[model samples]
Target: MQTHAQIDGFDPERIERDVRRWLERAVIGFNLCPFAKAVYAKHQVRIVVSDASTERALLEQLGEEMALLRDTPADEIDTTLLVHPQVLGDFLDYNDFLDDADALLEALELDGVLQVASFHPHYQFAGTEPDDAENLTNRAPFPILHLLREDSVDRAVAAYPEPDAIIERNIATVRGLGVDGWNKLLGD
Candidate 1:
């Protein structure tokens, strides 16, 4: 099965360093986007994400837009399954729980197929960040993950072993918080 491991650029060398340092922890290889450009038009970081729904014509259109829009180039080689942050309602709670990467990863229901892993993050060094302001981290824990049923792991593995249903469920959840709809981007 083909999977994509999409990541944004903060610092390419640092990202590679962290990924290498934590290679033992990663569940799957990543298709890292080496030069991620901040989406100036939109608040979110623009990435070349792909899914089952993105095919043929739509894919072509997105390819064109990605060229026109600010974007990062594909970087990591030989990796599938997107590794990303799970959106949480509260940022403080999210920051507070990052202290225990091992505990957090241990909590995941990874078997042979399931995987949980991430690298240390590079911050902008703003005092308002509340944390160290300059620490490498995965920003691991959040109560939103607590909502997931452990049994969901099996279903997720059956679907997409790397990211699986778990990530999709979370994405649906955050999108639900907005009036616009994830369907516009992710598809129906």
Candidate 2:
């Protein structure tokens, strides 16, 4: 659990309201796009991948569906070559992927490949420069794609009541949720 301040799409009351509002009208599907590259973090931009038919055999062998990418593309590397058709991983390991991201991008050399990382937006940051809007949206999770569809929200509830796995893993551990309804008090 964590205590987050009110921002754009996420509302304090509903928590995910801010995220849901922005994603409803997005055109491209993304899981999490951090504005920063392993240096600055200020917001959360998360989206989901809807297809697995474009990844190459190597990326698919990893069994990942969505990828957590930085909003700022590497000035030198061209990612189009890595986009392919294959299986993919759904989870995003923000910490692991963001660390030394530039050096790791070398794997993109393979053909027909895509990337997936933990659903974390540590790369997202709010800046003062007016000309930086383009950089901001690069990794922002605006339109989340659903492989299963919105109707399935309830199906997940029955299978993960009280958050058996996914929720427990996604959110932080020692967060200030004590001020935001600490689950420990309820013995959850």
On TM-score, the leading prediction is 2
In lDDT terms, which candidate is top?
Answer: 1
Q: Tens digit of lDDT per residue, candidate 1, span 1-188?
A: 32233343333333333433332222121112111111211222222222212223332433343223212222211112122232222445334433332243344322232222222223212353434312212222111111111233345345554554444443344334332331122222
Q: Where's the lowest-lDDT run of ten residues in candidate 2? A: 78-87
Clashes of 1: 10
For residues 1-188, what per-residue lDDT tens digits would candidate 2 score against the true structure? 44333332333334234334323322122111221221112222323322234333333422232132222233322111121111222213333323323233435331123332222222233443323222223222322222111222344346543644432332332132321232222121
Candidate 2, residue 59: Cα displacement in angstroms equals 14
Q: How accurate locally, in lDDT, is each candidate?
A: 0.28, 0.28
Q: Which whole-number lDDT from 0 to 100 does residue 46 have in model 2?
A: 29
- Cα RMSD, each candidate: 19.3, 19.3
The runs of at least 3 residues in candidate 2 whose Cα sits more than 4 Å from the true structure, single-residue gaps closed, are: 1-17, 25-113, 117-131, 139-188
In terms of lDDT, model 1 sits at 0.28
